[model samples]
Target: MTELLANHVCGRWQAGTGPGSVLRDPVRGSALVRVDATGLDLPAAFDYARETGGAALRALSYAQRAKLLADAAGVLQAGRDAYYAISTANSGTVKSDTAVDVDGAIYTLGQYARWGAALGDARHLADGEAVALARDGVFQSRHIQVPARGVALFINAFNFPAWGLWEKAAPALLSGVPVIVKPATATAWLTQRMVRDVVEAGIVPPGALSVICGSAAGLMDQLQPWDMVSFTGSAETAAAIRGHAAVARHAVRSNIEADSINSALLLPGHGPDSEAVRLLAREVAREMTVKSGQKCTAIRRVFVPGALYDAVAQAIGAQLAEVAVGDPRSEGVRMGSLVSREQYDSVQKGLAGLMAHTDVLHDGRRRALVDADPAVAACARPVLLGTRSPDAASLVHDMEVFGPVATLMPYRDLAHGLALARRGQGSLVASLYGEDPAALAAAAADLAASHGRVHVVTPEVGRTHTGHGNVMPQSQHGGPGRAGGGSELGGLRALDFYHRKAAVQASPAVLQALVPA
Candidate 1:
């Protein structure tokens, strides 16, 4: 029997009771651990965080809380190697992928910490200068932001255990609110270990940060009005969470980042010979293989000019063919397996659904593996499908396979391409590749309305441009419609999600007392 991972609740580690769900290694198909929360007290966990953890964090000034966050980042950064090892076994991610999650989490925490300096020592943040409410200016009105008096519940996705936990926890903790993290059961071990490190380091107060592994059953029932819930998963699950009795009745605040069928477009002037076409082809392939295309921000749709359709498709297909799929630890393996057998089946089903309307341009499904057995590991080769009649292919725009797969479509004109891109309803990101600066700018400006972020890929910036799938702390990371209508991680704006804003009307003397000197 493998080790049964423990849950961190109320400042202690407790072993779970009864038979638990088994977690397997994606690359080797071996049982890695068992996760359960049978005996844990969900209500008590919530109360402890609110009463104990929330109190502790609230007592500290903004600067003090920020310093603690910086300290926690240092501890996690020192343990990066151990996290990479765990990610390879559980998430089946290559070295680069692990860095993106682990290193990115650490960097985000540090950025938040440094950003705290601008917040000052004030416990309450003033929204703006005072406004005169009376003729004599004796009575003034001012708006202020304060940390919520309740705890934050973070329901994370399995695709990014480390990054997901840190990103949500950092903002909540910085804003003086306690956090209760419920990592996706399939990959909870890495998150569990991270919480353990932070706890042992003693950088955060007891109950400030907690983790619940296994099932999320009864967790939402414990939420209060002041409590906030941040979730990242499928749009279907997000809808279910929104409809939960506790959420709907008590009006518990919730933020969601759900399914996104992100798209990448190549402008008309960029043909096969243009550097812009090459850059776009490379970016699409990179998004497909990285994290096995499990990212919500990954490009699922590629739009190209009708004249350059075959040229772009063949270029991307050739790039996809060179990608090696096998065990993440194997030498020269660039792409790894899906997170589990269930995910493998899901991707195959999605591919079959896509094949219904689109023709296969590149089929790597039958390709030979490097060091692992395709039958034993949860591996699926990258597949690319194409459709000339994108308007007729409803499934291509609506479905998100969530694996190493993408669909290519040709548009008659820029207007047609924009229409096809908007068919995703809304997306986390969209990329426009072209040499003509004016054309790229115009397309990006138009796409901005439907996307949270837009990338303009040109030869000059191609060398330094962060790829489409990468999410930085300084940019908003949410979208509208199918992508979930919530925004987060736009620098200090992320703090707004954790804090409540209100208007304060009082005498000028009282106003001065309310704001820090």
Candidate 2:
């Protein structure tokens, strides 16, 4: 029998009482481990986290909690090699792709640690200077941000089990809040292992961080009115979470990262040989091929000048041609399989729907899998679809394939391109590529209303430009509308989600004493 990945709840590792669901290696289709959280006392877990873990964490100064986060990062970094192996077997990621998830998690944690330390020993943050309420200036009102007295529940997606866990945990822990992580069952191994390592390291208070795998049933029901939940997954599931009693009736705070069809736009003036066109093609291809394009921020839409459509497609297609899809351990395999057979079928179904409104620019679905059988291996090849008339194809504008797939659409000019990009309704990011500063800025500004981040790439940036899909900790990672109006990871702004802000109206002396001097 495969060993069940135990759930860490109520400050202890507890095994499920029933036969568990099996997690398999995507490439070999072999069972890797089992996970089941059934029969665990979730209400007790939530209470323990809120009463014990939350109290212990909230008692620490911001600087102390920051040090704890740094220690946790070190624990993960020390065992990084083991994470890489798990990513390969369970996440179906190549070495480079695995590094993005594992290393990215470590980097985010360290960044938060550094920032949290700068906040000093303050347990609560003054929003700004106190405002005088009386002419004598004796009475004043001060706004402050304090750690929530409740727990944080993270419902993560499978594409980035490692990064997703830490990106949210870093801020939550630094803000002196306990977090319970429910990573996607498909790729929970890495999350479970990382949490185990950190907990055993004794870096954090017991119950400060917990991992519950398998069923998410009754998890949301465990949330209290003051507790919060950060979810990343399909929009449908996000809706269900929002409607749950804890959020709908009890007013439990929620942040959601749902379906986003992010885009990359080439300024109208950029011709086929222009740097803008080259940059857009390169970045879009990278986004599609990276992690086999399972990223939430991956570029799903490409907008270019009408005259440059064929050139853009051909350029992106040529680069994607070099990619070899197969087992991650296989030498020369540039890409690996989807996280599971279910994801494989979902992508295929989405691809078929997209094909109805567009023509195939580069079809790799027929590409041979390297060192793996096509029947069981859940691999997919990079595919680019082009639609000349994007306005008519409403599905192309809004649908997110969520795999190594993208749609190319040609626009009349920059204005037309902006209009089409906005048709995405809302997105996590949109990149503008052009040498004309004015044109790039205008396009970026226009896209900004809908996108959380606008990536501007000019020839001057050259190789220095971070890829369009790289969700840096320095910038915001969520978007409005269909992208799920959730804000995350904008440096210190991330701490806001884990905190509760209030305006305290009191005497000047009392207000002054409430926060750090």
Candidate 3:
């Protein structure tokens, strides 16, 4: 019998009733573990999270809840070795790729802890200065935010099982909302192990952090009016989650991170030999191969000055050519297999669809794997596509292959480039590479309405700027429109999602007393 990974909820671990689903190793294509939630009671678990976990967390001040996050970070940091092993085995990620998920989660949690503690002993957040409702100072309305008396349900994507869990949970827990995580089944072991470690260490209050694995069949069916749901996956599934009764009728808040054909633009005057162009080429290659381009923020489109198109392609192709794809444990493997066979098939389908729309400037798919068998491993080499006709390449701007694939296109001018970037409709991030500060600023302003975050990388800051796909906790991680009109992780703003804001019309004295000093 395959080892069944247990679900942790209601202060204990329990296995599902049936044989359940088997999760295989993507690199070796061997059945490694099972995840089954057939007989677990979700409603009971939700109730416990609210009644027990939520109550305990809310009873403490923001500072106290923040300490819980800090302590949990310590616990996970101490057990990171196990997480790395599981990441390589189950997700087929290289050591550096695993660090992005594991270390990134640890850093984000610690960042939230520091920020939350700065809030002091406040139980609620003051939205703004109290506005006078009366001519005299006798009456006024003060908007304050209080932790909602509900639970947070996170349905995470496969590419970031570890970071996804903590990125959502850190803010939810800091805001005094208990969290129940449903990690994508393909990479549940890493997420499951992290949750178990935290729970066993008693880092979080009982029922404050729970994880459910296997089928997500009835998970959305268990939401309440006071609850919140945060999902990271396809736009189709995001739509279904949005229309679910919990959200449509009961008014449950939902944060959806759907399809985003994120772009990177090279500002005018940066020739292929310029430092700006060199930086863009290196960053593009890094984003494409990192996690095999499974990241939502990974660059899917490249918009460069029309004159420098070929040079840019050659530079990026050269960088991508150096990457080795195989089993992560192999000595020289820099890229690993996709999370599962399903992802491999999906990327291939998406790649084929886009290939018909663009020219394959550089094809690494034919390259041999380092130590992995073609039939057993789900490895994918980086492929760069290009098109001379930007106006007609609708699929290039619309489709996201979600693998080590990216399409490069030429734009006439800076304005034209910004317009081309906006063709993505909306995106989580759009980076601008240039030496001209004025041009960079102008292009950034133009793209702001269509993108959630703009990463401006100049030659001066090339070494210091965070990479394109790296989602920092200080900046918001979501975007508008097709990218999913969701907002998260803008420092204290993240806590707003788990909090309910209300305007209290009361006496001046009472209004002042409602907020922390």
Candidate 4:
């Protein structure tokens, strides 16, 4: 097996102190890589980032830091082919699907770079002249932007390892803070490869970046007042990290993006024969199968009008039937296995719980594999469970399978459908299908309280739609409550985490003296 070593401190790579961990190819069920992360010195890694790396990064202006991010993006883009090749081993994704995550990062970095360049050298800006109280003709207060004198610790999830890392990377780096990433063990190899490519590019400072492949032992122990921590994973995990005593005592910034039970609403305007209905059907199936439906924003609950339940179910069922499951590297194969047998088993357990709560409308093939080795069990099907009273709130809210599984609940009417969609307390995203402007507006306003992102799926956009489950770099990716009340990506909003906004109380003439011209 190919060995994946732990990359720590700045520009340093090492072998683990304990026996290595083997990562298997989900499709072939053969070992693909062995990762070593034992004896990984978390304290040293954290110190290197804070003391050495943070100084190098913070010394540069935001514009210079953004340029570094842009240059790194170019280097990473040149190596995109290699990233895709490595990702296939994990399975359940197409080249296009991978691009959405990988390319999205590049796009985000590029955008942040431009934003920083626009900041110029202005530290304090005069909103307007305020009347003075201390002295006659004297003014006070100006908005000033200052970089935090600390490091950003990124704890990423396994599903979208690249995107998760970049979502925080662009914002924090552009805001003039160094980043230390701790990728999920399951997919840390891919992240390590990316990190290696960046380091070799020589665009970033020596200590501006670091990676840890194993447990974050003393990393949290070394956090300081201005340090920032961002995590993308389960709610429980995010909560634990937020509650870290060291982090709390130091008043470090903590951002959490957790997995949530998101939903999609189907409005009443679209007829069975309408193009919009067909498009929504395809979108639903795609979300169920894409990434083996391992995405945090995947449509966990799908709501349809009671009169159109059968039509929606039939359309999605037919679309899912054509999905070929086998090795992703093979031609004509649309879907692949989960990250591992352990993940497959976990999906099954979640599906069992979902099955108990609702009736199955379109249950995907689970008994046997279709195209791959018969001995090997593939990931479960694109499930469509049916619920009678979706508006009841207790039936379908907050239920998520985190796999190629979703529920289709029939609503009494348009108003009822919106209410059903809001049943999920808070979500990363929710998709709506229909052409009725009034209905769409009402639904969006009602569900806005629960969902962090909303997608209006229509025929015009659906024909060229990228699907409902995708997350972009410019938009906020996290949700409220169940989705971890943390925000990621929102342009400058993300950068605020790595920066501290300070109000400077001084005369315009004094500010002018502080910043010439």
Score residue 16 of candidate 2 by CA lDDT: 90
TM-score of model 3 relative to the true fold?
0.99
Model 2, 144-191: lDDT tens per residue?
A: 999999999999999999999999999999998999999999999999
Q: All candidates' TM-scores?
A: 0.98, 0.99, 0.99, 0.93
Model 4 lowest lDDT segment of ten: 122-131
**Candidate 3 residue lDDT tens string, 110-228:** 99999999989988889989998889879899998999999999999999989999999999999999999999998999999999999999888898999999889899998999999
**Residue 43, candidate 2: C-alpha displacement in angstroms:** 0.8
By summed lDDT, the worst window of 10 consecutive residues in model 2 runs over 268-277
Q: lDDT per residue, candidate 4, 206-322, as tens digits?
A: 767887776666667767777888888887787788889856666788888886888777788667878777877888888888888888988888788788888888888888888
Error of 2 at 212 (Å): 0.8
Model 4 lDDT, residue 223, Cα: 79
**Segments of candidate 4 deviating more than 4 angstroms:** 121-137, 366-371, 374-378, 391-395, 464-466, 513-517
Against the correct fold, how does model 4 do in TM-score? 0.93
Top-down lDDT ranking: 3, 2, 1, 4
> Model 1 segments beyond 4 Å from truth?
none
Judging by lDDT against the true structure, name the best candidate. Answer: 3
Q: What is the Cα-based TM-score of model 2?
A: 0.99
